[model samples]
Target: MARPFRRYSAGARWYDVLSGERWVYRAGRVAGIGLMDLQAGDVVLDLGCGTGLNFPLLRRAVGEAGHIVGVDRSADMLAVARARARREGWSNVTFVEADAAELDVDGLRARIGAATGRATADAVLTTYALSVMRDGAAEAWRRAVALVRPGGILAVVDMQPPTGRWRILAPLARLACALGGADIHARPWRLVARDAAPGSVREAAVRGGHIVAAVGRSPGEVAPTARS
Candidate 1:
């Protein structure tokens, strides 16, 4: 069992600095959000939103008119996220502490609806999060995808072994992931590859392909109707 939620609890305060955001990782979030093509008033769900690392990007993409509902299982992580929001004076973000893999999408939708007056979000994003879910990752992905409105977006960014020449760093990559309580081989981006509209999927790689971001339009933007 992953005990790092507790381990992470102690490190939440310094996650931004110690998480290697500057030297690595940030590019994945950038590419993922860029592919989202988010508009000004969209509501976005940030799953496993550890310390709100994606907040600045999501915030910039959505702007002040939009809302962000971040869900994480760690109270400590959410505490940092909440503090970040307060520091930035961002009134548009909300943090909910719950396991994304086990989240109640209907209730979550209701909560989001109550806040945004919309039953579903315009986009759903997860970064280096699914792989950490272990056995719960698939259910988490399903619930997160279901939380988006039809025609909305699903973006996932995660890590795998470094590719080609970068393979020389494979051991280092595994070390980073293992230390971070992540499954380096997850390749969770496959979820988007398998489910998105054929032409709507966009993919990008960074850090020698150790990190990947995939964005795709959800199935059925509009419900089919009866013909006259």
Candidate 2:
């Protein structure tokens, strides 16, 4: 199936309003970033970074010395992201148009190296987009992690059906995901958690579990959790 760029194309202009940013999705990014614990001067990679909604929070965390490289397959989305950079005066942000599933990792490294003199990102993040990957979320997650420095942070913020009393909201959640072409069943965050170190991984369920955030480190010092 073709990617869902069409859902975002003409509608890209009103996505913040139409996508339920306030009442639903924003909590995921906020909670996810909190767990990532990003540091200033860090070079962060945002995969499937639709319209750069995460830019402001990321900018605050990275500070003036840091840079953000946002990669998205949708040109319409990137156009809005570029405008956001200009409007917000965020010269530190750069947008690269590419598919997350079939990423050109080395080319990206070279481009980033040329632009910011950093070949690898200090952190890799994806919010609400990995599940849409055609090559598979696990492969996309692996590729994203490979772009990060070994000890760098890896974070994923994606959607799932709400739980408990929030289960009442399941229909609405499913509707929203369906409209956006996301897989409500695709718990892509598990890929990150699977590779994360024992003590370094933290998970959160926000919007009453409609959004799930998993923050962890790339394969490194933290010991792997032993299987039973």
**How well is each residue in 64-136 modelled by candidate 1, as lDDT tens digits?**
9899999999888999899999999999997888888789988998999888888888889999998888788
lDDT of all the models against the reference?
A: 0.87, 0.83
Per-residue alpha-carbon lDDT of model 2 for 1-228, expressed as tens digits?
275557756678888889999878888999998888888888889998988989999999989888999998888889989999999999998888887777888988887787678677888999998866634667767788888876788899999999999999899999998888888888888877788767778899988888999998876642222110
In model 1, how many backbone clashes occur?
Answer: 0
Top candidate (lDDT):
1
Clashing pairs in 2: none
Query: Best candidate per TM-score, number?
Result: 1
RMSD of each predicted structure: 3.3, 4.3
Instruction: Give the TM-score comparing model 1 with the true structure, all chains together.
Output: 0.94
lDDT of predicted model 1: 0.87
